[model samples]
Target: MTPEALSGETLRLADAVAADLEGVERLGVAYSGGVDSATLLALAVRALGPERVVALLGVSPSLAARERTIAHRVADLIGAEVVEIRTHEGEREEYRRNDVDRCFYCKDELFTRIDDEVARELGLDAVAYGENADDAQRPDRPGAEAATQHRVLRPLARIGMVKPQVRDVARVLSLPVADKPAAPCLASRIPHGQEVTPEKLAQIEQLEAALIDAGFSDCRVRHHGDIARLELPADELPRAVAPGIREQLQRAGKDAGFRHVALDLGGMQSGAFTLQILNARGSL
Candidate 1:
């Protein structure tokens, strides 16, 4: 679809979300600074004004430092009040178990803090999170289950807007994250049942930051104990093998404490590991 047409559709859907939130006296957005959440936060600010919208960002071992930094910047640009809450999902045994429902525990912790404390303290009448239509259709997203249990709102998904349409509207709204790629929690880099650790998450974050500094916009450094399996986009595969570039990445991986560095020929894919496990179980 044409950019203008896509943007138009996005606006219509965003308006639908705003209309859904019309009765709320104040709303707290479970913001992650991702395009999905950022777009929803912007819509809420437009609908209820900045004073009525609060961007509740959860800080945890799973959240990458770079993402946390950008989240604050995005909230500032959106003119929404930002609240940083430290979530202890890592300390939760169920979450650290790293099962398929790990996200469920993490999100449950986040929403509990939001509803039980943040919302009440801020006098928010409602709490909403960004779950795009595509995300709702996806099989690997267990976090949505927690959102459902908490009765948290999903404005974007309810309005029938997908990722592409969210980006279209974000571009029209001039959101900084308009083209920002999906960056799930650092814990996602570890394969299921590995037992998520702060060290592993930190290592993943360092390696990913190195790749980003090396000009990779979207990448993943899957933690496999002493080995780091790098996943870059198909188009960027050449760079991964290129002279000098390969050496620099080798050094970066080594610095991050990986004894061996290997690039996945399959290239970059969000939740590739989880999807593989889920598909194996026929959960999709």
Candidate 2:
């Protein structure tokens, strides 16, 4: 859609993004199929045409299969070609260390892979990510530091567009993930100090997908060794405790190889593990 097709602040926001991306012959967006990235992809397509834009999805054990499918679907919807780049952050000891800077290692590996393997072949003039104003200011995202080191463009954050603005732009563009809750990497569900492994990630994915299939719209199956800590939205907490739902969740958790299934009454939290660690260090 053209900038004239949009109106008011959304139009102004879109214009700002287009202006930021001007003069780039070809652009690649680091896409995760989340609303933020999806919005950036859509905006880039609008600005530079789908032919000049590519959505680069980093495939790894950390990324859920469902998310991968969604990334492709969203790219198709936005008229941008999708390129899957297999990342090996798992091979990095720093990433497996699972400390607060784990995201930095993961992102660094992705950017390095892109720089070494993708940019030249794809003839990409520039690369951008979906960091919004809120994420730009957040202390928990060490991945942002990696983006800075790689000089990845952050149009949304640069234009001061926050989460709500990104969602609004998604709505204007009719993106499917407009209201989708934040779905961090499967590794994020594992607490700090815990080694991130494919097995743990698989377990988390299985249980989280099961929870979604069980009718909970927003949920997290946090991996705590053998314990599967289930977190659902506060409003859905009562339904989750209902006899049938509770039993189903218990069965699902067990099927995912968890020794115990526990509900977090505080509800689903975004970046709970990272925030907890950062807070403990008095960093935030």
Candidate 3:
């Protein structure tokens, strides 16, 4: 669609989200600084005013510093009260187990904390998140299950908004993250079954930041034992393999403590390792 047409659709979606929030006396957003959550926060602020809308960011070892900064900036732009809650997902054995449902335990800890501290203490009417219609159809998002268990509201999903719709609305609202790439938790880089550690998370974050500094967006530095498997977009493979770029990346990985560095020709994908596991189990 043309930019203008997309903008129009996005405005409509934003209006719908705002309408839903209008009746809420006080609403807390599960803000992640992602385009989806940022867009929803913008709408909530517009609907309930800044005083009634609270943007809650769950801080954990898995959270990237950049992500937290962006989320705070977005909340500032909307004049919303941003609450940074330090979460101990790593402390939870179930979460640190790194199973397929690891996200479930992480989010469960998050929402429960929000419910106890933010909602009850602050007297918020509801705690909402940015899950959209597209995510509703995705089977592997265990976090969504936790959100449901905690009775967290999903305004975008409730309004029938999908990924494209959220992006469109974000553009209409002029959110800085309107076109930002998805950046899941740092622990996501570790293959399932590997215990998530603070040091490992820090290493992944630094390596990914270096990759971005090297001009590779939408990438992942997947942790595999002593090896770092870089996943660049398929279209960027040629650039990534240019004369000295591979060596540079290898050095960066080695500095991060990887003994060997390899590029995955299959390229960047969300939950690539999880998909591999699911496929191996004939679940996909």
Leading candidate by TM-score: 2
Q: Which stretches of candidate 2 lie over 4 Å from their true place?
A: none
Writing each residue's lDDT as its tens digit, candidate 2 over 154-250 gives 9999999999999998898889999999988989898999999999999999999999899999888888888999889999999998989999999
Model 1 alpha-carbon miss at residue 139, Å: 1.2
Clashing pairs in 1: none
lDDT (C-alpha, whole model) for all candidates: 0.90, 0.93, 0.85
Decreasing TM-score order of the candidates: 2, 1, 3
Runs off by more than 4 Å, candidate 3: 1-8, 282-284
Taking all chains together, the TM-score of candidate 3 against the true structure is 0.93
**lDDT for model 1, on a 0 to 1 scale?**
0.90
Off-target runs (Cα >4 Å) in candidate 1 are 1-10
Give every collision pair in model 2: none
56-156: candidate 1 lDDT, tens digit per residue: 99998889889999999999988889999888998899999899989999999999888777778899888999999999998999999999999999988
Ranking by lDDT: 2, 1, 3
